[model samples]
Target: MRKLIFMFFTVVLAVGVISAQDDLSGLTGKKAIKKANRAFNTFKLNQTNGGDDLKEARRVIDYVVKQDDTKEDPKTWVLMGDIYNGFSSFNQAQKVLNPDWENIEPNGGMVAFQAYKKALELEAGNKNALDGLSQIIGSISTAGLDAYEAGDYMGAFNSFRSILDIHDLLKENGAASPLDAEEEYDNQLYITGLAAMSAGQNATAKPFIQKLYDKQYDKPAVYDAMYKLTIDDDVDAAEDVLTKGREKYPDDLGLLFSEINHYLKLEKIEILEEKLKFAIEKEPENPSLYSTLGNVYDKLYQTNYKEGKTEEADKYFNLSKKYYEDAIKIKPDYTDAIYSVGALYYNKAAIVTEEMNALASDYSKEGTEKYNMKKAEVESLFSEALPYFKKVEKLDPNDRNTLIALKEIFARNNDFDTSNEFKMRLEKVESGETIEKSYFQ
Candidate 1:
């Protein structure tokens, strides 16, 4: 009698387990769906605790997705994408034993892509799907870049081509397209251009690059590529391209600066000066404007000095000084301007000293009397230059260049005491001692 009871209990337990499995197998109806969704949510939360629970979460998501009744629901497709994305993220953190692994599958991205694609397929003007697809495409593009950097050119190309495919698909379906369809199409042209350029096929690259330039006129890289084409012997062509760029981006200071530099190279000083003046007027606060103006003045000084126009050269030098000072005032940390001003002062002192020496030697009879006056003027000019040199030294005490200049100046003037003091200070500076400021009163 006891053995018979045990057999009957076993049979009942097996039937109960079978019935429970059937209930979980293919849930149907609204109430069943709500239960499946609740199960999915509970599994998703459990997955966050990691460890063994992640596998349980995946099983729940898979089971929910496998339900034939819910397969057609768009939300189910989206949930599938989310699950796949979760797996991918987990795979990315593979080093972690308890990683969220559901995100690794490309199908997840594709599922999201297709979900939106299908949504749009159903309702042609669905903005939500369009936006979601755009996002998925962008995500795919980033993934492609990563693959490319890992030497997966085929992967990169495939990723980029996917975007183009989507564009074509949108066009074919009469769905809304990007604002610049032609330009969008031209991206393929740019990729080809980059490939050709990499292979040194300049001629082949030219047309593609030119088309891109025509579309995006103000892109520096486009100008740069065109500029490289003419760098050897086509200065005129280069100038023409730059002129076009200037016309397109008139307010671009870099373009204006480059134009001025080109004019300077071509020896068109008047035009260069006009451009510089215009830039100054437009951006007076730009320290570069003053620095460039200083450069122009320095160039003028060089020309006048070479032509033996002492007075004209002196005037230009003073103008250079003013411009450089303006630059420093605008940006106190402008080391180049500071250095230029210091060098200019030294040059002025040298010229004045030369004048005094000539006057003293040529007029010996009127010497001592006239010599004292002229020597004093020379000394004053040298004194003016001294402060600037000292400033350079203080700013960069270990600057061998500034030290050499100071040494030469003092040696020439027979101020050995002062020169020796500067040399010691420089040594101390180089040894890591902090130097204090030495200002002129």
Candidate 2:
């Protein structure tokens, strides 16, 4: 009797399991949608109201979505989209609690977007799908913002990209999108490119950034960004953008600086000189142009000197000095030009000292005479730098680079106390502490 009772219980449990598994498959047409609607309603009421509601919704919708009668129904697609969207919500909520909820389903946003898009494609007047698409777009935009604020740049890029795709899909379906087509396209493309670049997706960023450039966005930073991306792979392409930017934004310092950087990277000193000269011709009174030219000549001097071309190096050094003096003559209070002149003297003196030290020791009589003569020249150069650096200190009292330069100059001259004072101020500046204002005075 006990064996017979156990056999009866086992048969009943097996029948129950089959019944539960075949429940949704057994229904068709309206009956299937009715069951799905109930499960969806349960899901909507409380997303975490056990996973059964969403699971049943998915089961019923999956079955109905493939059936002949319901396959083309807009309502069926909407239901499917809603169910998957619920899955996304559930996974996100669960992840907060467990932090290990591995998402194995299709991306909820994309699935929902495509499903609702199809529903709308079938019937533009499908209010449910339209509303769902709008909500999805909002959700995607919000997700992008949240990711960006959290510094998850790739996540932000993906979310923004989806928002763009959904809006495009809506437009393709003859439905009016909530966003302004032109303005939103430009804004979205810019942000998407920026986020992609920030996430180190250089290839992905190129098209979007190029789109902005093609539209003549008139933003200097955009040119800078595009050039930076193309510089390593296609330098000619980078130069083209820089040239266009210079033409459009004649006074934009960023583009000017980027052009300078490009030439410096290529080590095309002569081209750089010509470019700077042309720029100065365009804006003759712009002191910054001369100062920039001076810096380029300084670089050329170093390069030529390194290559054993002493005459070329001396020629470049004279040109650099001439440009700096021109800049100063045009604007006496031009702090940058003033600093460049000081830097030029200090750098030249450093080179001379290095060469002399390499040749002889100061202990020998002949070496002593040579050392004293070279030392006098070096001290004279520092003396020339002194007044400019002092002037710079007065012009921009809190400038850290100037403070460092002053410290080095004073130390080179063996004025230890003044050098130590500047050193203290420099350390305070570097550490973000306040230095005594009277010290600069």
Candidate 3:
């Protein structure tokens, strides 16, 4: 009985101590702040290098945050942020000490960010919270870049998104944001949009891209991405976006090209012609533009020829030659333009050959003359294309296309020996063998 009574008294004493500790109504404004600061100092001093010190710091700060008089106080929130920051620091140090210890509790950075954000909400111009927020932003930015470089795009997207969210929240709450508003949004939006698109998260990318477009952000890539995303489902809207982008960024070649591509897709040939002409006007010396225009006319020539409109087909073929000549004049050694010109002559000759093959055998005197004239016309066209193909070979000695063209052109011109040589070279190129000497040279 005496032992039981002593145990009861011990339990009663323990309950009284617990009740007093749990009761924080008496600990208000100044007292609560003082205790929080003291706990913070103890944690910072790292006297014990133990979890107990950090736990105690968090307990005191949380108590201050929960107290009636200090619940709305900016100072209380600042203390909460500091406690969490200390938690993060302690966990980092502990991880260094014990490399295997991975389960660091409470996500200290997130907690600190939230606490700082709350402090700013309560006092928009709070310098302490702003400084802490800046540190958090810097850290997050670093994390995002690391994740991006590692091809962890989703991780990078989340990191960048958090930064934007914080900035937006600060602005929405009438806080004095330290971030350069327009520049920050522009950079973050572009990266986040691109990351989201790369991750195959179209739903996530749309808003970011739309925001950039709406703001007329001076980013050509945004317009390009926007058009690519919407071109299939809503072509008109995509073209409208392209038009607006071009209007705003008149010199942006990307937007100009996107506009050209849109009209090409719609089969609006007249519009395509106009757009290409305008682009050429803007950059008359750009070889690529002339090359593209040449290709466009090549396609049109084929279209007209297929409809049996030989006269119209000849017109487009001549136009194609003009552009190809223009491109070659600007960039004399342009391999692609040179190849296109050669292909044009070769194909036109093939058409004439088809016509000659369609005629009857010319054994009679008059028939022989007609057949020979038609054959000469075919050979002349192939001859015109031959030197251009040879030039292409010199410009790009290892080009597979050039090798194939040389073999065919020689065979057509009845130079069987030279044709066989080019065929051997083409076989070697296809087999990935190194060619020591230039075939044409």
TM-score for every candidate vs. truth? 0.56, 0.55, 0.66
Task: RMSD for all candidates, in order, please.
Answer: 10.7, 11.1, 10.6
Model 1: worst 10 consecutive residues (lDDT sum): 50-59
What's the lDDT for residue 195 in model 1? 47
| TM-score leader | 3
Residue 40, model 2: lDDT of 82
- Tell me the lDDT of candidate 1: 0.65
Q: Per-residue lDDT tens digits of candidate 3, residues 1-441?
A: 999999999999789546434645677766867866765786677646466556766777777787778889898888888777666666556666886655344356667788988988898878888777666665566556757887988888887787787677666655555466678768888888888887788778889988887887877899888987787779788888788778778888888888887777777776777789899998999998898888889988988998999899999999999999999999999999999999998888888787787665658887777777888998898889988989988767778988887888789878999999999988888999867777667
After TM-score superposition, the amount by which residue 254's alpha carbon in candidate 2 deviates from its true location, in angstroms, is: 5.1
- Who is ahead in TM-score, 2 or 3? 3
The TM-score, computed over Cα atoms with residue i paired to residue i, of candidate 1 is 0.56
The local lDDT score (0 to 100) that residue 139 gets in candidate 2 is 57
Error of 2 at 412 (Å): 15
Model 2 ranges with Cα > 4 A deviation? 1-30, 42-72, 83-107, 120-131, 250-260, 267-350, 353-368, 375-441
